[model samples]
Target: MASMDVSAQVSDEHSAARGHCDVELTHGLIITQDTIRIVDNNQTRVQINQGNQLLVRGQWIELDAKETEILEQYNQMIRDTVPELVELATDGVNISLNAIENVVSGLSDKEPEVLKAQLQYVEQALRNKFKRGDDFFYIAPQSLSKLDDFFAEEVSKKIHTAIQGSLGAMLIALGDALESREGNIEERINDVGTRMEIITAEIDKSLKKKAEQLALKSEEYCNCLNMLDNTESKLQKLVPELADFDLVKIKSDLQYSTH
Candidate 1:
């Protein structure tokens, strides 16, 4: 079993686009091929496993004779949905990486080896969050936060480094410009410096735009997972035993709220 935490902050646009109020995941969910486990803050554990098995607080629950019908219905729903969820998650990772690559590739004609390696690391990190073994796949709660950090922090840092590295080529161009002019070296130097500032500003503007795009994509991915919370709600309603047990809770907060 693998575990991770995922958090998503919705933008006004995202909320409007989905036609729903902002939502957040209050607790993490551990999803496997045949089971979904929710561990609350108080260390209370509730799990729904294959074959209509339910465990609460580490004890197997015995359903009433009439409850068997509800159990079977829940099991069938899970059996129909888990594979689709896995497919959607896998696709989400691929789409995110492609988005990152598109942003990073714009930095230079030929992408730096360092950036390529960083991308690989990111892919591996994301894949690690979704554990797939011989017979099961798992989605941990931490995966969304990792995704957010990858684009917001790690990728942003790499982009800045790569952009700064390109300044060396600019300096070489400055040298060539200075060599071609013989008089007024100080004036020429100042002129080159001003042009360099302009170039730097342009790079910064481009970087900011790319970063915004990445941030939006990250939020979009997180928003997609909101469906999982909806599923959890449905399960609770279907199984009376789960009425008080929150398999997954999503809450909305203002700090990460987007304009």
Candidate 2:
């Protein structure tokens, strides 16, 4: 809202020594050579002994309505320009500190050329970061590193969006693939269950045939009962219900038949 004011200050005692007053806006400190100009929301205070036409020089001391509007427009232009530069740079580029320094140094002397160089530097840096991906995240320090990366990612994403165009089909395809994979897993599980059932039926038939082949003698039947008990114990490890099988009753019946 406040424009910079540059003024010449002179006092009666030290009128020979021409002094200048330039207030630093960035810091809220009042700085003056021999006089001070204080402005508030209400009014402005100008302190100087007005001697008729004593080479008074000031930059309007403040901005008028028109000047303020123009200043705002210029600020907005700067903001817009920087983002555009970042986007352009991030496309595919590289920038060195030296390049940036050179561009900045030339800014005062060659305004147009310096601006172009600055844009190029920004673009190169951004492009490099985008290419680096996760690796580039921690490369920069706190000062300007974070800001540079932020701008680079923003620009890179913008470029990607522009190139890729539509995302609707891609999303739909992803969803369909996920659904298909889930169905395949369910079918495989059902197949496994069917195979397990067939295997269990075959094992049951084999166990019955083995029991019929063994002849019952007194000691042999006792030993056979013991072996079956042991077998059932082992089977319980694989199938929990096998542990509840009538091992004790079967052993008693075999012993009775043998006697």
Candidate 3:
């Protein structure tokens, strides 16, 4: 005859087995779902399905897995698509800054009629530029006053030169002023372009990092689902034979001699 040691915990005292095993897990006075299990060294080795399933066999192997079926509820937390972030930058310079710069550079070479035409062109560009917006460059507001001030200074100097009495002197003054102004304008454009390049690279880097993170998380989630599916299939195959289980005989088989 084999000896059995059993321990039972029942909140309101429920019927237990006739002391068959060494340890028995029972929670009878529970209002909600509870569990029955086998405890080995205070660790549960056999559990009657209540919550998450964690199996420990022998000394080293354990199988604990989560199912992604539950992830459907929180799937909305994952972003559907990575945003395409773009950054555009422009300063007080107009869209036609290049064209105006060309006109200014050639002012000394053009006749007064040509100068008048070029001036008219620049005037129209300024008007349109003020109304235009850089939709991509949304980080900062367009400094409208700053743009107006720049245009005002440029026009004031050029108009003053154009209205001079002597054509030779007028050409010299206009050429000098425009050259200086064009140099400054070129510097600003170059600066803006360089900054724009930096911004674009940063945005690209950020998007790439986010894509990698999303991919990694998706891979992990998929792996969890696969593990759960495999585990459930294996359990379904193994658990039905429980009707023929003989615990006392199995324990006797596992008993070993100590030196």
In lDDT terms, which candidate is top?
Answer: 1
Give the TM-scores of the predictions, in the order they appear. Answer: 0.42, 0.15, 0.21
Full-model lDDT, candidate 1: 0.52
What is candidate 2's CA lDDT for residue 171? Answer: 28
**Ordered list by lDDT, greatest first:** 1, 3, 2
Clashing pairs in 3: 5-22
Model 1 collision count:
9
Pairs clashing in candidate 1? Answer: 4-141, 4-142, 5-141, 5-142, 6-141, 24-250, 24-251, 25-250, 26-249
Off by over 4 Å in 3: 1-183, 227-259
Better of 2 and 3 by TM-score: 3
Off by over 4 Å in 1: 1-17, 21-34, 39-44, 78-82, 92-117, 142-245, 250-259
The residue pairs found clashing in candidate 2 are: 89-123, 94-124
The sequence of per-residue lDDT tens digits that candidate 1 reaches over residues 1-259 is 1222222333445565443323333444455667766555536477778746888778887876546566656455545544444444454445544554564344334444554565566566556545555666555444333343444465445545544454455444545656766787557556645654554455445445544554455355454445555555665665656777653344455323454
Tens digits of per-residue lDDT for model 2 on 26-108? Answer: 11111123222222232322212221111112223244454334333432332332233333323323332233334333322
Over 1-259, each residue of candidate 3 has an lDDT whose tens digit, in order, gives 1222222333112222111111111211111133323343444444433343322332222333433232221121111211111011122223233433344344444444544554565456444332223321111112211322333444444433333322444355545556756466446444534543453344344434444443343333332323333443445344433222212121222122111
The residue-level lDDT of candidate 2 at 98 comes to 34
